[model samples]
Target: MTDPVRVVLVDDHVLFRTGLEVVLGADPRVEVVGQAADGVAAVEVARAARPDIVILDLRLPGCSGLECCRRIRDELPDTQVLVLTASDAEDDLVAALRAGAGGYLVKDGDPAELVEAVLGLREGRSIVPPDLAARALTDLARFDRQAAAGPIGQLTPREREVLALVALGLRNREIAARLFIAENTAKNHVQRVLTKLGMSSRAEAAAFAVRAGLLSPS
Candidate 1:
């Protein structure tokens, strides 16, 4: 038989963490190896246990979920992160993905789906909601059309391509693969696009893409 997936739960709420331990522990294929009440402890436990997957919360006391995700990706490259958050804001989702989260799930999601998402991550697949995916695609398309006709029409085709992907919630590495460019090259293009558009972050780019009708509404 295959080994069970090792998981570490991280959240600020003690009650929530306890409840999750009970639920996830009951699964035959999942083993709850550790639990942390905040991001700091989460990182420590993750490093110690070296779990296959880390179930992380978006908001914590010491460090935010986005920062935590970045740290986990850097420190535990082998472990996948699945984000569980109460916020469904597009910006938050984009931020989490950019920080290297393998999955993004709202708190209201069914327990079964959450477990399934964790299993899917273990199987090497990401689990983003269908609605979020549709929204991302719409944002990409909208950004494309607007950039084609806007004053910034001077942006080269390649820059426009990078812009659309950025608006679609893709990270540098993912965009690099999709565009057939080096990761550093992708990062450079994203930086240039942000500078040209006077934006500080990808979230701003996404919002601009949406407001400009560069993306279709889902």
Candidate 2:
């Protein structure tokens, strides 16, 4: 039998944190291992708990959630960090992703959606609220497009080709078949593209490709 997904909750509000613990605890597939009201304590608790997922909030006393997320990710590469906050600001979302959060969800999101996100993150999937997805992509592309002067130029010729195919909406398997490379090789190329472009997800990378004219805008 598979083990339940262990999770750590980090939020400043005691009531909110308690409510979340109860909500997530009700899931038979999940087990709440620890909880913290601040970033510093969050990391300490997480390091000790060694949970499969961390439900984090952007606002925290002392260590700011972004730094905490980065530290947690650096220390626990296997643990997925999911940002659960009330803020819908694009900058917050972008910063969270850049800090290595695997998922982002507003607190106003439905309990079912939040539950799905937690499960999805454990399965190695990136999660974002459906309502914010399109805007999030546009925001990420715009931010990177402005901060990065010719970000595509940073990629090798082969990576550029991979990015273009990604923009064309091909999955890794499809990209491998189209490029006549091994599937793992295609995935590596995609990872390289995302790393070089400072993109956390393929959606951001695809948007970057279009913005950079690597893929023709329709």
Tens-place lDDT per residue, model 1, 127-155, is 67878755655444544655545734656
- Alpha-carbon runs more than 4 Å astray in model 2: 141-149, 154-190, 198-218
How many clashes (backbone atoms < 3 Å, residues ≥3 apart in a chain or on different chains) does model 2 have?
0
- Full-model lDDT, candidate 1: 0.77
Instruction: Give the Å error, residue 80, model 1.
Output: 0.4
Name the best candidate (by lDDT). Answer: 2
Residue pairs with backbone atoms closer than 3 Å in model 2 (clashes): none
- Cα displacement (Å) at residue 70, model 1: 0.6
Question: Highest TM-score: which candidate?
Answer: 2
